[model samples]
Target: MTEQRQDPILIVGGGMAGALLALLLRHHGASAVTLVESHPLTLPDEPPLTPSFDARSTALSAGTLSVLDELGLAEAIREHAAAIDTVHVSRRSRLGITRLRASEEGVPALGAVVENRWLGFVLLRALYADAAIQVLAPERLSAIRRLADGYEATLESGRTLTTPLLIAADGAKSRTREWLGVSARDSDTGHDAMIANLSLASDHQGIAYERFLNDGPLALLPLPDRRFGLVWTGPRDQVDAWMEMESGALLKQLQQQCPAEAPRITGIGERQRYPLILTHACAQAVPFGVVVGNAAHTLHPVAGQGFNLTVRDLVQLACTVGGASAPGKLSLLQQYVQRREQDQALISQASRWVPEMFRVQQPLFAHSRQLGLVAMDILPGLRQGFARRAMGL
Candidate 1:
C-alpha cells in the first residue's frame, strides 16, 4: 500500500481497546485517528442501555494501568478503582492455598478493579473531547475493499472512508477481522461465566479470591464501596440454574463456598452469562492493516490477561508505526506480531491449562495440584515472579 500523509487511521470499534488504540496512535503523533463504533457514539446525560456501561467490572493490572499515560488519558482511575493488595488462590474441598501479595513484590498494589460503566465514562469522555480523534456512532462496517494504496470501508450508514491503515479493534466477533480474511482458532470450554455484583457484610480488605471448585473456577474480586465482583464459571446447566435461583439461595451457596473469614454475601446484583471461549487470530497482520484486542486473541478471563496483553501490543504497535512512512507495510506489521509471540503464547497456555488441571476429578491430579500450590507459596522467587507477571509488570 502506498503512503498518504493526509489519510487518517481508521479503527473499527469504540470499545476499550479500539478507543484506547486511537488515543495511543494520537500519542505517537498521528494527525487524524478515527474510531467507528457499533453503538451510538453519544452517551446521554442519563445512562444508556449499553452492556459496557454497567456495574460489571474490569480488572486493571499495574501494567495495563499504563494505558492512561500511553493513551494520553488525563483523568485518574484511582478514585474509580479498588486496589487489590493480595490475591488468595485456593481449591475448594482441598488443603491448598497460595497468597500473591503486592507488598511482597515491592509494589504498592497488585492491581485494581473498576466498574465497566465508570471506565467507559472516563474513556469516552476523553474520546469525545479530543478533536484529533473522530468518532462515528451507530455505524457498523458493512463492506471492505483492499486498495493498492490502502483499504476502503463502507459503513452501514452509507458512509465511506479510506485509509492506508485500518485496525480491527472490534470485540471477539470482529467483522473487520472477517473482512480481512483472518482466521481465528477458537476453543469452547463447555462452560459459561456468570457475572454479577455482590454486597459484602464485611470489608473485603483489598483481597481477591480465585477458587477452583468441582464445577469450575470461581473468582470473587474485591471492589470499592464494600462490594465484590463475581465471575463464576461453571457448566451450562449449573450456570442456568444459578441464574434462575433466588437471591437468598444464591447468597447461601456463595457463603458455603467462601472463606470462613470472608464477609457474608448479603445481596446479589444483575446476573449476566456468556460462554467461555479461547480465540486467537492466526494472522494478526496483512497488507494495509492489522487486528488487535479481542479480535486478535480472545482469552479466558482466568487471570484477566486478555486486555493486559492486548494493551502491551498496542503500545508496541504505536511505536512501530508512529514515524514510519509506510505504516501499513507488511514488514512492519510482521515485526509487531513477532514482538507479541512469547507473552501471548504463555498467557494463552496458562489460561487454558490452569482450569483443566484444577477441574480434574482424579485423586492423583488433585494431589499434584495441591503440591503445585504449596510449592508456589514456599518458593519466594517463584512467588515473586508470579506476582509480578500477574500484576502485568
Candidate 2:
C-alpha cells in the first residue's frame, strides 16, 4: 500500500479557479497539491450541464489574459478565444450611445471571450500534465477537522486526506467554507440571468454590447462565428416565462431591449438559468483553511467581473502560499486579507452601482443617467479610466 500523506496541500474544487490555483502553485515551485471535485473530471468534447464546465462563456479581462500568458496557458486555448475590440453601451429609448474602443485604451484588445468548456479543457490538460498535482473528482468534500498545524478532509466516498492547508474553491455554496463556519453577506439582485450561446444575424465584429433596459442591464458579449454570448438578466419571476417562450418571440423581446440597430438572435444553445447574487465572506481564512474564487466572493455578473476578481484572488493566494514555509500560518492568511480588502471593497461598490447607472425607467432619473452616459463618451480621461478599471487594471 502507498503511504498516506498528511501534509499535502489539498484543494477542494476542480473548476477553473481551483485547477488554475494548482497550476499556479506548481509554477511557483510549490508541490504536492491535491484537488477534489464533486463533478466529473473528464469533460467530453461536447460537455453537458456540469458544475465545473459547460457552454456558458466568460469574458476574460486583458489583465487575466496576461496572467494566463504568464502561466503559459493562454496559447493552448487561443483558438477558442475571440477578442473584444469595442464596447458599445446604450440605454433603450435614448440617443446617448457610449463607445469604448481598445485602440483608445492603447491595448491590443479590451478582452476576450471563451467558452467555459474550452477553458475547463485547457486547465485540465495543464493540470494532468503536471506531475506534482493529483486530480481527484466524482468526489466531494463532506467534512473537515482542523488541527493545530493541519486539517483533515473527509470525502463523500469515505476517502480521507490530511493537509497543512485547505483551499475552498468550491463555488458559492461551498461546504468547506461552511465547515470552517465562515459567514457571508449575500444580496440577491432581484434578477435571474438566462445564459446561452446565441447566433445572431449580424456579426459581432469583435464588439460587445451593454444595453440597459427598464429592468436591468443586458450584455451581449462577442463569441466566435458571428455568435454572441448572451447574459439576459431579467426579473426573477418573469425569467421562467421568457425562457419558455418560442425562439422568435423571445428574440423579439431581446431585440426590443437592445439598440434599434442591434442584431437579431437567430439561434441559441442550451439555456442555463442562474440567480444573480452578490456575496462577500466576512472571514476568508481560518487556522488551516482558506476560501478563494466564487466561494470567497460571488459577485453579480453586471460587469462580468466575477471571474476576474476570483482570478486575482487565486494568483495572490498562490504567490503568498509559495513563499510561506507554512501555508496554514495565520500571518500569511492575515496578509492576504489585508492586501485584498481594498480592491474587494472597491470592486464590490463599483459593480453594485454600474448596473444601476443603466436603469432607464423614470423619465427624470433616466434622463439624468442618459446625460451621464453622454458625459462618459465626451470625456476621454473619464472614459479611459472606466475602461482601464473594467479591464481589471
Candidate 3:
C-alpha cells in the first residue's frame, strides 16, 4: 500500500473562483495551496476567433472591486475592463425604461465588464507571481478519499495528494462534487443564452442595457474597441433558430430588437450558445470538502450576478480560512459553512424566484416587475443597497 503524505490545500478547477481563492489565500498568509486545472495554462494559438464572443463575462461590482483591490489585482483588471456608468432596463412591448446611474450611487462607475478569458489570464499571472501558491494545469482530479485528519486526491496522472481541505470550483458540471458524493439539484429552464460581440457603429457610452421581450432577456454590455457583448436568452427552439441564422440576418434581427442602439451595430464576432440551468448543491461544505462558484450554485445569467456571486463565495471562504489556525481543518470548514450558508441560500432563493416572477405572463407580475424597477430608480437607499450587494460589499 502507498503511504499517505501531507499535501497543501487542494483546489480543483483553475477557473476564476479557484484562481482567485488561491490568490486570496496566499494574500492572507495561507501559503500552502495547490490548484489543479484540466486545461493547459498556456494560451492557445490563433485563440479561436469567431463571431461569437467569450461565453462568459462578469460585471465586477464595487465590493468585488475592493476585494480585488485588496488582493492587488484591481489595477491589472482595470487595465483591460470596460467601465459601465449606467444600466438601462426596459420592456420591448412597453415604453417603460428604468435607468440606473453610477452617479446616483456616488460611484465613479456602475461596474466593469471583462471577458472571461482575459480575466483568466490575469488570474494566472497573479498566481504565477505568488511563490506560495502552486498551480498544476492540464491535470484533473480522478478520485478523492476522506481521512480523519485530511483528504487524499488522486489525479488523472496517477499522482496522489493529501490535504486537509478540498475546494471544488470546477463549475456547474463539477466532477469533484460527484467524487465526493455531493448531490446537486438542477433545473433546466428550457432556455439557452446566445452570446456574441459586435462592433457598434456608435459607442455604448458605458451603458448596459437589458431588454425584456416576449421571449427572454436581451442584454448589451459595453466592451473595448467600440464593441458590445450581448447575452440573448429565449426558448431553446428560438435560440437554436437564432444560432442557425446567417450572420447578416441575425444582425438585422438584433438591430430591430435594439432600435436605440442598432445604428451602433456593425460586425459580429464569435457567437456561442449555452443552455441555462439552475443548480444548487445541497451543502457548500462537508467534512473535508467544499464547493464554490457554479459548482455551488448556478443561476440564470439574466441578472449578470452569477460570477459576482461566485467571487463573493471566494471572499467568504477566504475570510473563514484566514481566521483559522490551520486553513483546511474540519472545524474551520464548518465555520466557513455557517458563515456562508445564509447568504448563499438567500441569493439562490432570490435568483430562482425573481426569474419565475418575471417569466410569468400574468399582468400583475409584469406590473410588479416594472414597478420594482421604477422603485429602484427612485429609491436611493434601495438602489444603494442593491449596488453594494452587487459589488459584494
Best lDDT goes to which candidate?
A: 1
* TM-score for each predicted model, relative to the true structure: 0.96, 0.94, 0.92
Model 1 misplaced regions, further than 4 Å: 1-4, 44-54, 70-75
Worst 10 residues of 1 by lDDT: 44-53
Off by over 4 Å in 3: 1-6, 43-55, 259-263
Please give the range of 10 consecutive residues that has the lowest summed lDDT in model 3: 45-54
Instruction: Provide the overall lDDT of each model, using Cα atoms, as 2-decimal numbers.
Output: 0.84, 0.83, 0.78
- Cα RMSD of all models vs. native, in order, equals 2.3, 2.6, 3.6
Tens-digit lDDT track of model 2 for 205-297: 898898887777789999888899999888888889888988778877777777766677788777889998878787998887898888888
Candidate 3 per-residue lDDT over residues 245-328, each given as its tens digit: 999999989888883743468888888889988888887777778888889899888768877777777877887774355566
Error of 2 at 94 (Å): 1.3
| Candidate number with greatest TM-score | 1
Report the Cα lDDT for candidate 3: 0.78
